[model samples]
Target: MTKTKKPEFRPNDFVVYPAHGVGKILSIEEQVIAGMSLELFVISFEKDKMTLRVPTNRATEIGMRSLSSPDVVMKALETLKGKARVKRAMWSRRAQEYEQKINSGDLMAIAEVVRDLHRADDQREQSYSERQLYEAALERLTREVAAVSGVDEAGAQKKVDEVLVGRAA
Candidate 1:
């Protein structure tokens, strides 16, 4: 049988794992398990202080991806500037949808959640659950924005806040 090539991610590269936010590739290791050789990508998440090992073959299937391009990052930031589109559905349903978007590792979807859940100074405060989801989405989006834009996390957050402020004005 011909062996397939492994995924192209390398050490020191920033990647997004759908359920997690941004992580840096720590190393690639080969191991023998069940008498079969397996290649794994060891990733470290600074925010969570967690390390994860993903099989090379499963990286793409599991939605592990490189940082978004500058163009895509810009688009996501633009998404933040758009008006929020909160639905009239029940809170539970909206929360579920928001959770999915945040975990999908799609920058724009996370931005949408952040935009919809963000409350301006003049607007009504968000419910506890709303605030939780908003913070989760914001964290995910900001991490990616930081990685793609080559800025620190705080700077990325400030940029997002600036965009939201402009939108609110």
Candidate 2:
């Protein structure tokens, strides 16, 4: 409904999607959809070849948000090296929860999932689902970290893992 409050958005602002990492706000446009005029923020993610249009008014409620602060991102990276929490629950159920957390677009939550699922360099193999979730969370978290830290995704991810290693030792 049009009753949703629209937050002020800016071009070049960094945002995070639940499953995707940091993306930039590319443009704001008004489009007529089904006879209703709506304002949308066009976000671009080159890595994923994806462009998302989020309604300006419902951004916050839908979990569309700006990048986290460096300190916040740092805290998330530190979480990565902590011990994993392997629940005895079934994989499908856990996977659904993980997917929800990822889609929430909350950077810290995503980081927590990433941290809890990460396998150390010498750890045994992860199941197909585990590996998929791990990569999804890792990519989502690192992309936001990279945007906030002004580094590339690979470098940001490397730094996060390095920080984890330091904490482990």
Best by lDDT: 1
lDDT of 2 by residue, 66-166 (tens): 78888888788767667766688888988988888788888777877887777777878889988898888888887888889899988988887776667
lDDT of 1 by residue, 1-169 (tens): 4476668899999999999989999999998889998889999999899999999999999999999999998998899888899899999999999999999999989999998998899888888999999999999999999999899999999999999888843
Root-mean-square deviation of every model: 1.3, 2.1
Worst 10 residues of 1 by lDDT: 1-10
lDDT of 2: 0.80
Off-target runs (Cα >4 Å) in candidate 1 are: none
Cα error, candidate 2, residue 43 (Å): 0.8
**Residue 145 shift from truth in candidate 2, angstroms:** 0.8
